[model samples]
Target chain A: MSEGEIIIRAEGLTKVYRRTSGGKGFLGLFRRRTEEVRGLTDAGFEIRRGEVVGLLGPNGAGKSTTVKLLTGILTADGGACGVMGRTPWLERRKIAADIGAVFGQRMQLWWDVPVLDSFRLLRDIYSVPEARWKARLDELTDALELGGILQVPMRQLSLGQRMRAELCGSLLHEPSILFLDEPTIGLDAVSKLRLRDFLRAENRERGTTILLTTHDMADMLALCPRVLVLGRGRLLYDGGLDALLRRYDTEHTLRCVFDGGAEPEGLPPSVGVRREGEAWTLTFAPAEIPVGEVLAKLLAAGPVRELTLKEQDTDRLVARMYADLKLT
Target chain B: MNIRAYRTAFAVHARQVSRYRGAALGGMVTQAFFGVMLVALYEALAGEGDLLRETATYVWLQQIFFRAFFSTGGEIYEQIMSGSVCYSLLRPVDLHLWCVCREMAAKIVGVTMRLLPMILIQFVLPESWRMLPPDSPVAFVRFALSLLTGFLVIAQVNMITAAVTMRTLDNKGFSGLINLVMMILAGNIVPLTLAPERLQAVLRWQPFAQMLDAPIRMWLHAGPAGEWALSFGVQLAWLAGLTVFSRCLWGRGIRRIELQGG
Candidate 1:
C-alpha cells in the first residue's frame, strides 16, 4: 500500500454477544437463559487517509461497537476488518501504534497528576522522540488553548479543560488516524465550537484521518463532510452529508404576509396552505413543484407584502430517516 | 514490547502514589497500631522467647507488605469496574506486563512511604517488644530475594483475579473471598507453622504460602539452608504456574470484556 491510501477497510463485519439472563434464584440457576445481542450485522465501510468521517446512530445502534471493532478492543465474530493494512484484532498492538483514540466518557489521563505530566507520560509511552514531542506539544498547547491548564491536576480541571487536555494527549504521538467518540458531548457552545475549529485545523494542516461519532448535529455540520449513518447495527447511509440532506430533505416551507389583511390564493393542488390573520404559510415538496413556479403562483394569487422560504432542517431530516428505517 | 511504555506506566502509578502521601501516612499509623496489638497478643500467648520475637517480626513484616501484596488486586478490580481499563487495552503495550509494572511501582511507593516509619517505631519500642532483625548480610539478601519473589507470586495471583473480574464485571465477592483465603493460607493473620501438620502440608504447596509465609520465614533465618532453598523453589514454581494460568485466563477474559461502565 502507498502512503495516503485506504487506511481502514471493513467488509461484512459482524459481532454477536451472548448475554446471560434470568439466572437469579435457585430454579433460575438450573434454567439459565441466554439471549443473543447483535452488536454489528454486516456493517461495512471504507475510510481513506485524511478523511474526516462521522458515524451517526441512536443509542444501542452499534456506533460504539463498530469503533471498538475497528480499534481492536472487541473482536468481531465474523467478517473482515483491516486497519492500516493489518487485521485489527490479530495485529492490535501494531495498529494501536498508528492510531489515537479518545472515548469521551472514559479518561486516559492520570487523575491526580498534572496535565503536563500526563502528556509527558504519554510521550514516553508512544516513544515520541524528544524534538518532535517538544514541537508537537507546543503546537497543540497553542491550538487547544491548554497552556494555562497544563500544570493543573486533571481531577481539578473543568470538563472542557480536561477534554482539551485529552485531545492534546491523544495527538502527542502524531498518530495517522484519530478516533473520537462523543468528543463534544457535554461542552458549552463556545467550547464545542472551539473544539470543532481545532479539529478542522488539525485535519487541514496535519492531514489526520479522523473518525468521529457524536450526537451533536453542530459537530457533524461543522466537522464531517462524509457521514456514515448506522441503524439497527446496519449501515443505512454512507456518503456525503450533503447528499444525505438532499435525499431525505425534500419538503420546503413558504411563509407569506398578505397586504391589507386580505388573503387570496388559488394555490396549486400539490401545495397545502395554512392561514392565520393576514399571514399564510404553504408547505410543499419542492421535488414535485419547482420553487420558482410555486413563487410565481403565490404571487399571482394576491398582493404579497413579504415572503420567506425555508428548507427542512438537517436534524429533522435525520429523524425522518431514522423513523423510516424503524430504528427510532 | 515497548520498554519505555512500560516504564512510563510504572512512573505514572508511582507519581500518583506520591501525590497521596498523606493517605499513606495515615495508613502507616493504622498499620503500626495493628502491629503493636498483634505483637502484644503473640507475646501473651507465646510467653517471651525466640518464637515470640519471630511472631512479632512476622507481624511487622505483614504490616509493611500489606498494601503491596493485598491491595494490588483491588486496584485492578476498581479499574475494571470503572471501565478505565479500556485505556490499557487501547495502548500499544502488553496489558499483563503493563499492569504488573504499574502494581510494582505502587508497591515500591507504598513500601517506601509506609514501611520505614513502621520499622522505626518498632525499633524505638522497648527491647522486650522489639522484633529481631536479619542475622547476616547473606541472610538479609536472601530475605530480599524471597520478598521480591513473593511480590511476583502476589502479582500473578492479582493478574488472575483481574482477569476473572474482566470476565465477570463484578469483583466485590470474588476479591473479598480471595483476600480472606489469602489471609488465612498465607499466614497474614497467624503463622502457618502453628497449624496442624496436614493443613501445613497442603498449604505449603499452594501459591498463597509462597506469597508471604515463605518470605517472612526466610527473612528471620528461621529455617535451615535446605528449607530456604525449597521455599525459594516453591515460590518460583508457583509464580510460573500462576503466570501461565493468569495469561490463559486473561486471553479468554479479554475476548468477553464488556467495559460495562460509561
Candidate 2:
C-alpha cells in the first residue's frame, strides 16, 4: 500500500437502518424491536491516491457510517467498497492494517495509563516496527507539541491534550490512509491550528491519503482542497471547496478601505453592502457578475486604498448544500 | 488466550484496580454489607436455630465467596452502558477472552486486598465466629485454581449480558431479572438443600448456583467439596458455552451497527 495508487473505490455503497418507531409502548414496542431503521441508502464516492477528502454533512446524513463501512468497522449490506484493492468487510484485518481512524466523540487512549503507555500499546496493537514507530511518534509529538504531557495518564490530561495524544495513537501504524472524524472538534484556537498544521505537514511529507469528516468548517478550509458532501444518505456533490461555493450561490465580501476617511460608493447592482464604523464592505455573487468587471467599476469610482476579498466559509457553503438537499 | 498475552492484559488491569483506592474500598463496603447480612441471617437460624453444624465457619465462607462472586463484574455493566465495548470490537483477541483475563486479574487484586481485611474483622468478633475455630488455612493453593475457574465462569456470564447491550438500547430487562431469579433459585441467602426438590434439581444443573452459593457452601463443609468440583466443571462448561455464544452474538450485532454517521 505504501507505493500503490487508487486508495479507495466505492460504488453504490448503501446502508439502510430501518427507522423503527421507537418510544412506542406495549403492543407497539415489541413490534418495533424487529423493525429496521433505514440509515444510509445508495451512497457512493471514491478517493484517489494521496488525496485529502473532507466528508461534509449534517447530523444523520450517514457520513460516519460511510467512513465506518470503508474502515471495515461496520459492514455494508449492499454495494462494494475497496480500499487498497481489498474488500473492506471481508478483508477487514488487512484493510485495518492499511488505514487508521480517529473518531472525535471517543478517546483511543487507556484512561488510567500514561499517554505514552497508550501510544506504546497502539504501537504493539498495530505491530509497528520499532524504528518507524519512534520516528512517527516523535514527529507527531513535536508537531502537535505533546512533549510535556506524554507521561501523564490520559484521565489527567485536558481535552485538547488528550486529542493530540489520540492523533498520535492513530498514526503510530503509519497507515497509508487515515480517517479523521472531527479531530478538531472542541479544541481551542491554538490547538486547532496546531492540529491542522500537523495534518498538512504529514500529508505533504508522506502523501498520506486522508478522509476527514468534521462539523468544524475550519477543518475543511485549512486541510482539504476537495470535499464530498453527503445528505440524507445521498451524494449531493463531490469536488473542490471552491466548486462547492459556486454551487451554493456563495457570497464573497470585498472590504474596501478608502484613503483619508473617504467612503467609497457606486458599486454594481449585484453587489450588496456590509456595514462597519467608517468602512463599508460589499458582497456579490461572482458567478452573477465577473470579479474583474465588478472590480473595474468599483475601482473606477473610488480611491479604494486596500481591498480584501473573502468568501463565505466552507462550513456555511456545506450547510447551504445540506439544506438544499433537505437533510437538515 | 496465550499465557503471555493474558499476562500483559492481566498485569495492566491489576495495576489499574490497585491504583484506584476509594473505588476499591467502596466495592469492599458493598460486598461486605451483603456478606454480613447473609451471615447474620444464617447465624440466627444455625442448627437448632442451627442452619449448619458450625455457624461461624459458615459465616466466614459467606464472607470469602460472596465477596468473590458478587463483586466480580461491576465493570462489565459499565462497559456495556458507556459503549467502550467498541474498543475491543475488531481486536485480534476474542473479546470475551480479553474481558475474562482482565476482569479476573482485577478480581484477584481486589479480592486479595479486600478479603483479608474482611476476614480479620469477622475474626476479631469472636462471639460472632465461634464455629470457624480460627485455624482455617483457606486451602489457599487449591481454592485459588477453583476460585479462578469459578471467577471466569462468573465473568463469562457478564460478557453474555454485555453482548446483548450492543443489540438493544434497553438493558433494564436482562441483568435485573436474571439477578432476581438467581437470588431465589440459586440459594444466595438460603441453602439449595433447603429449597424445594424440583427447584434444587434445576439449580444444581444451572450456572448461577455454581457462580455464587455453591462455592461458599463447599468452603464451609468439604463434604460438598466433591459436589463443588461439579460447580467448577460447570464453570468451564459455561466458560466455553457463553464465550462461543457471545462471539456469535457480537458478530451478528456488529454487522448491523447503525454507525449513524453524521
Candidate 3:
C-alpha cells in the first residue's frame, strides 16, 4: 500500500512513566524527589486505511496508553508515529477533528442532561457543522437503535444502552478514524452482539478506520478481520485473526454420531473417543494429523451418521498466544 | 493550549455542569446560606457594627467578597482532589485553557445568580444597608482588576495544587492547608488593618490579599484607590508569576504522572 493507504504508522513507539522518590537521599532527607516507573516499553504497529483493527490484551497492557499516544493525549518518549499524514502531538486539533474515541471506562456524556443534550454539546466540541451533526445523529441513532432512549439522561441508561450512546457521542463529527478502547466491556451478551453488529455495519458502510481494544475475544471474532496483539507493552503479533488460529491449531474436537452401531474400537493416538450409546466424542490434536484425516479414520471405524468439528475459537487461540508470549 | 478550541470546551463543560441540576441548586443555596450566616456572625461580633473600624456598608461588601472567595475555592479544589481531572485530560481540548474558560463562564454565572442575589438580598430585599453605595472610578476599576486578579490567582493556585496532586494522591491535604493560610492572610477572616499590627504588616505583602483583601478594601473605600490598585498590581504580578510557575510545574508533574488505580 502507498503512504495514503496507511492511516496510522507507528515505529518503535514507547512511553515510560517513572515513580517519584521523595527527598531522602545522601544524608537522611536532603535531596529533591525522583521517581521510578516504566509504563510502556518498545511498542509499535501500523493500521491501514478503513480497517477495523482489534487491539486485544489483558488489563494494563499499555492499550490505553497507546491510544492516548495516537490521539495526542500523551507524547511519545521514544520513536515516532503519524496519524493521517500529520504528527498527532504537533497537529492535535487536526488529528482530533479526524478521529473519534469511546473510552469504555468513562462516559463523556453529561449525567444530568438527557442523552440528546450531551450529543449537542459534543457537536460543538467537535465543531461539527449543523447539517453534518444532524446527519450523523440520525445515522448513529438508526445504526445503534438508540431511538427509544435518546431523551433519557445518561445515568438512567443501562450499561449496554449507555455504551451505545457513548459511541454515538464520539462519532458526532463523522471522524474518519475511530478508536474504541473496550467499547463493550461489562455489557450483557445481547448488547454485546448488538454492538458487534453496529460496529461491523459502521466499518463496512462508512469505511471508518477503527482501532478497537478489548479483552473480549468475541468482539474480535464478531467484528474485526484483522487483530493487533499487545503483551507487556510490546506488539506480540499483528495479522488476521485467522492467522493466530492457524498458528496454534494443535487440537480439534469432534462429536460423532453413529446409526444402530456398537461402541467404537481401535481409536488412534491422535484421537480420544468417549462412547455414549449412539454418539461418540473424539478429541484430537490436529497439528500431528489433519482433522480431516482423523475424521476419515473415525468414519471407517464406526457406522458414522453425523460428524461435527468444533472450530478453533479466536479467544482460545489468543489466550494460548498470550501465554506463549508470557504476557498473562 | 489552543485558545480557539476552548470556546467549544467551554460550551461542553457548561452542558456538563448543567446536567448536575442538584449541584447548581446546592451550590447556590450553600453560597447564599453561608453568606447570610457569615454576615450574621460578623454583626454579632461587631456589636451593631461599631466594634470594627469600617462602617456597616464596608463590612457588608467585605462579607460578600469573603463569601465569593471561599465558595469558588472549594469547588475548584474538589475538582482537583477527585480524579475528575481525567475527564479534561482525555478530551481533544487543551486542559489549561478548557479549565480557565469553563471556570470563567461558571464564575460569571455563579456571581450573577448566587453571589449577586445574596448580596442584594442582604443589602436591599430585607434592607440592611445602602443598596448601591456612591462609588469612585478607581474603586470600580480596582475592584474589576481585583476580580480578574482573583480569578487568575485562584485558578493558578488550583492548577499548581492539581499539578502537585498529579504526583501525590493525598495532595488534597496540601490544598486544604493552602486554602486556610490564604483565607487568613488575605484578610477574609477579618480586615488586615484590624488584625495585629505585626500580622497585618506580614500578611499585606503576601499573595492572599490580591486574592481578596485588596479588592474588599477597594470595594469599601477603606483605603485610597491607588493603594487598592497597587494591591491589585501586586496581585497581577503574583497571578502572572504563579501561572508561569504552575505551567513549569505542570511540565515536570505530568512527566511523573502515574495514574493510580481508578
Candidate 4:
C-alpha cells in the first residue's frame, strides 16, 4: 500500500443500543422494556496511513463505540465504514489480519503465563515468521523497557508493566493499523511517557496508521497532531489540536515571582490575576489582550525575578470547547 | 481457518491448565473419593452382581469425563462476563473453532492429569470396586472414537451457551440449570439402564446420552455391532447438527454483542 493512503474511512456512522430496563425480579420481567440508547449518530472521520490520530471525548461520548465499530467489535447501526477498502464488520477477519488493537481496560494476554509466552502465542495467532517475530519482539522490548519483566507472569506485573507487554504483543505481527483505546489509562507518569514515546517512534519509523483514544490531553499533545472529538454520539471537531485551541481562544496562565513584595499594576482588563505568597499568576485571554502587552505591563510594574508562561492547557481548552459546543 | 492460530490457542490452554497442577491433583482426589463412595452405595443397593461392577466402572469413568467434556460451560461464562471474549472474534480464526481448540486442550490436560491416578486408585481397591477394562481391542478403539465425537458435541453445546450468554449478557442460574439437566440426561449421575425401560429407550436416543452413555456402553460391549454402528452414526449426526446450529447462533449473536467494559 502507498504511504498516506486513506486507510480508515467512515461516513454517517451510527449505533443505537437497545438496553433492557428493570428486569430484576420475577415480577419485573413482566414489566421489562427496551430503551434505545444512541451510541454514535452520524459520526464521520477519515484517517490516512502513517497518521497518528487521537480520538478524544468525555465519558459516554461515543469514542469507544467509534473504535469498536472500526475494529469490528461492534456493528454500526447505520452508515458506512471501511478499513483498507473493506467493510470492517462484514469482512472482520480479513481486516483483522491487518490491524492490531489494544483495549486498556481489557487484556489480550494470558493472565497466568509469563509475558513471553503470551508473545509467542500472539506470534502464532498472527502467524508471524520466526525471524520477523524475533526482530519485532526485540525492538518492542527495548522500546517499552520490557527486559526486566519479560519472564514475569502477567498477573504479577503491575498495570504499567502489563500494558507495555500488551503493546508488544499487539505489535508482534507488524500490522499496518494499530488501534489503542485508552492505552495510557492508569499508567504512572514515567510509564505513560515511555508508552507515548514508543508509539510516536513506531508511527514515525514504520509509518503505521494509529487511532488512539485517551482522556489524557498530554497524550494527545505528545503523540497526535490530528484529533477527532466526539460528544454525545456526534463528531464535534476534527482538526489539528493547535487549531482547536486557537479557535476556542483558550486562556493562557502567566506565573510571575517578583524580587520583593511589589505587586503588578495597570493590568489589562482581560487579565485575571491571583496571588499566593510571592508568586503571582496572571490568567488572560490572548484574543482580548496581546501576550506581549501583558508581559511588558507586568515587567514595568516590578523587577521580575522569574517569569513563566503556561500556554493554554490542552485539557482546559478541550473542556471549554466541549462546554461551548454543549457536548458535555 | 488458520491452523497455526488454532494450534497456538490449544497450546496456550494446555500450558494454562498445566500450571495449575495443585488444582488438578485436588480435583483428582476429590473425584476419586466420590467414586469410592458411589461404588459402595451401588454395591449396597445392587448386591454382588455384574450390575454393581458395571455401575462402579460407570461411576469411575463419569468422574473423569464430566469436567473433561461437559464442564466447559463455566469457561464460556467467564470469558463473556469478563468481556475478554472479544479477542476471539477479532482474530482471523473462526471464533467457535478457536474456543473448541482451547477448551479441548484444557479438557485433555485435565483428563490426562486425573485419569491415571483415579484408575490406579480404583484398581488398588477391592475387585468389585475396580473398573473393568474395555471388553476387546475393537471396543477400546470404538470407545476412543466415541469419546472424541462426544467432546465435539459437548464443545458445540458450550459454544451455543456462550453465544446465548453473549447475546443476553446475563448467565445467572443458566450454568447451574444446564449442569443439572446434563448430569441426569447424560447419565453422569445414574446409568440410563437403571431408569425405567421406556424412559431409558427415550433417553438413549437423545443427544445428551450420546455424549456419555453411548460411548461408555459401547466400551462395555452392551449391545451388538449393529447397535454400536447406529450409536456412532447418531453421535456423528448430532455433532454435525450441533456444529452448524451453534455456528449460526454465534454469528447472529456476535453482531448484537455489546461488549461490557470496553
Best by TM-score: 4
How close is every model to the real structure, measured as TM-score? 0.91, 0.84, 0.82, 0.93
- Model 2, position B215, has a per-residue lDDT of 52
CAPRI class assigned to model 4 = medium
DockQ metric, candidate 2: 0.27
A1-328: candidate 2 lDDT, tens digit per residue: 2244778998888876654464577767556554565556776777887888998888877788778788776667788889999987677766666787788887666777788877766666566677988998888888878999988988898889988888888887888999888888889999999889888888888889999998888878788888888877777788888676677765877777666666546666678876687566888887887777667766776687778888776667766777777777
The interface root-mean-square deviations, each candidate in sequence, come to 3.0, 3.6, 4.6, 2.8
lDDT of 3 by residue, B164-223 (tens): 776666665877887788767766555575777787777777877667666666665737
**What does candidate 4's lDDT look like per residue over B1-262, in tens digits?**
5688788778877877877789888888888888888889989887878888888878888887766655444344567766667666677777778788877887888788777787778658999888888878898889999998887788787777777777666775665577678888888888886889888889988988878888898778846788889999999999999999989998776655643323
Model 2 quality (TM-score): 0.84
* lDDT: worst 10-residue window of model 4 chain A: A1-10
> Over the stretch A1-328, how does candidate 3's per-residue lDDT look in tens digits?
2123888999888887654454655653555565645556777777888888888777777888788788776777788899998877667777777888888987767665689877876776666778988988998899898999988988899999999999998888888899998898899999998888888888788888899998888888787888877777878788888777688766577888877674556667667777776778877677777777776677777577887888766667767777888887
lDDT by residue for model 1 (A1-328), tens: 1246898999999988777777778889678698788988998889999999999988888898888888887778889999998887788778877999888987787777789888887887778898999999999999999989998989899999989999998899999999999999899999999999999999989899999999887799898989999988899889888887777766798989877665545667778878877778888887788888888877877788999999887788878888888998
How would you class the docking of model 2? acceptable
Steric overlap count per candidate: 0, 16, 6, 0
Q: What number of backbone clashes does candidate 2 have, counting pairs of residues 3 or more apart or in separate chains?
A: 16
Q: How do all the candidates rank in terms of TM-score, highest first?
A: 4, 1, 2, 3
Per-candidate DockQ values are 0.43, 0.27, 0.27, 0.50
TM-score of chain A of 2: 0.86
Ten residues in sequence with the least summed lDDT for candidate 2 chain A:
A29-38
Query: How far is B239's C-alpha from truth in model 1 (Å)?
Result: 1.8
Task: List fnat, each candidate.
Answer: 0.46, 0.10, 0.20, 0.52
